[model samples]
Target: MQMSWHRRMLAAATVAAALSISALWVAPAQPSARNGTYFYMVMYRGGRASGPVESEMTLTCFPEGGNHPDPGGACMALREVGGDFGRLKIAHADCTMEYSPVTIKVLGKWRDQRIKFIRIYPNRCLVAAMSDWVLNFP
Candidate 1:
């Protein structure tokens, strides 16, 4: 059957609209229970003459309700990347934190270790766990 270009375009547009609406109506993926801000330190081996270098990272999380005014209430996730560490995933629940043994590839050879919501301040949070990385958003 031969459909006019206008008809085809209309069909495509309808499908697109339906997909968009479905996406809007569908609930967001349930964030891990362990969520909040966290700080992490990473150490890398240095050359014979140089000592091991240490890097600092922070992770923070926000719950469905929104940002927690207190650091203890904030939520976040963390992951590690590159080198021998591979990729590590971590999350924070309340005051405690949890980690994932599995690692994933990110960018080139650099693997990342992720840590979420370890609690830094009251209501404030840290999101990413990469050295010097800070969480500015609420």
Candidate 2:
């Protein structure tokens, strides 16, 4: 069957719009089990001579053999590493200790922070802090 050019263009446009909408609706992929467990640390820089002082907090998602270790669980470790300023070691069940750069941003409240890291297993991730002082797993 032969169709008019206008009709064809309209159909194409509709399909394109539908596809765009679907893409927006689709949920993001879940983080892999290997990348589940994570660590974080918060550091407060003191005076120039004093350098930086740090307070530690550990956050984990998995509860004793529940899939993979939670990213929140890793927070404490990360915080410690941060306190040391990238000199701390991170040991995982995978039995591998590696160092990678990380960025932590406070999203306000008790649990609205964002954490970003690269070349460290899972690549990119987002963590939200909760009122209970526990960070919400990504």
Candidate 3:
């Protein structure tokens, strides 16, 4: 009788262990589980109504590579500016002072934090001069 009781207890323990392992496999993925930051960025002439020249594409940083054409360059640019568009370092260029505006809209997650940003540039060249090709999709 004692031997049978011991066998039952062992069987219950085995079942519990199997259930625990299955639960782990079925658990939902957390945001932090992602490889890196993800963003959907749009570069358009004038306003959003003007239509995106580069539509919206996924951009990732820190081991970068997404839909963005130059992932490595874009990630490096963001790192240089510490992910702050307003703080982008202007590159030396002979940019005209003439105003023909271009706008950029970035909306997505960065470092697991939600983000929405917008900036306007005098022209495409001026945008290119700042933050390298961070704004240039292709």
Candidate 4:
């Protein structure tokens, strides 16, 4: 009877893990994901480890709107770099050499092009250093 209970628990755990993995697949399948100038961003803590999501927000450049605190500012920042995350430049002056570790996943369309980028930073400050307007939520 104990063996049966253990097996049942294992099966439940496996199913939950599978669901977590599926959400992190980084695929652009939904209609919202393919929309114009859309960006779905998620921040994760724990240094490149995909354990749990810390925060997330959606930014739409075409119309400049989402849950982002400053949609207009973020859109302007993106325009400065032509909607290229790789070209995102540092706007801040200073940051520590902390090893707290933070990971960010961004996916969606920049105008007509499909965009996908995932990066792990030494700390949250670095992420903001890359781009405060586009990366900061609060």
Best by lDDT: 4
TM-score of each: 0.26, 0.27, 0.61, 0.69
lDDT of 3 by residue, 1-138 (tens): 356888999999999999999999999543223754777777787855357474567777776767788888877877776677667677777778888787888876666667778888787777768757676655
Candidate 4 lDDT over 83-117, as tens digits, reads 88878878764788878878888887887888888
lDDT of 4 at 73: 88
Off-target runs (Cα >4 Å) in candidate 3 are 1-33, 48-55
Residue-level lDDT tens digits of model 1 in 33-115: 35422233322233221244323322233322323233232222223232222133433434324331111111211122343
- Which scores greater on lDDT, model 2 or model 4? 4
Write down the TM-score for model 1: 0.26
Candidate topping TM-score: 4
| Every model: Cα RMSD to truth | 15.4, 13.1, 9.4, 9.5
Measured with C-alpha atoms, the lDDT of residue 32 in candidate 3 is 29
Report the Cα lDDT for candidate 3.
Answer: 0.72
Per-candidate local distance difference test:
0.33, 0.35, 0.72, 0.80
Clashes of 1: 41
Candidate ranking under lDDT, highest first, comes to 4, 3, 2, 1
Query: Which residue ranges in model 2 land beyond 4 Å of their true spot?
Result: 29-34, 37-138
Residue 58 Cα positional deviation in candidate 4, in Å, after optimal superposition: 1.0
Q: Give the TM-score of candidate 4.
A: 0.69
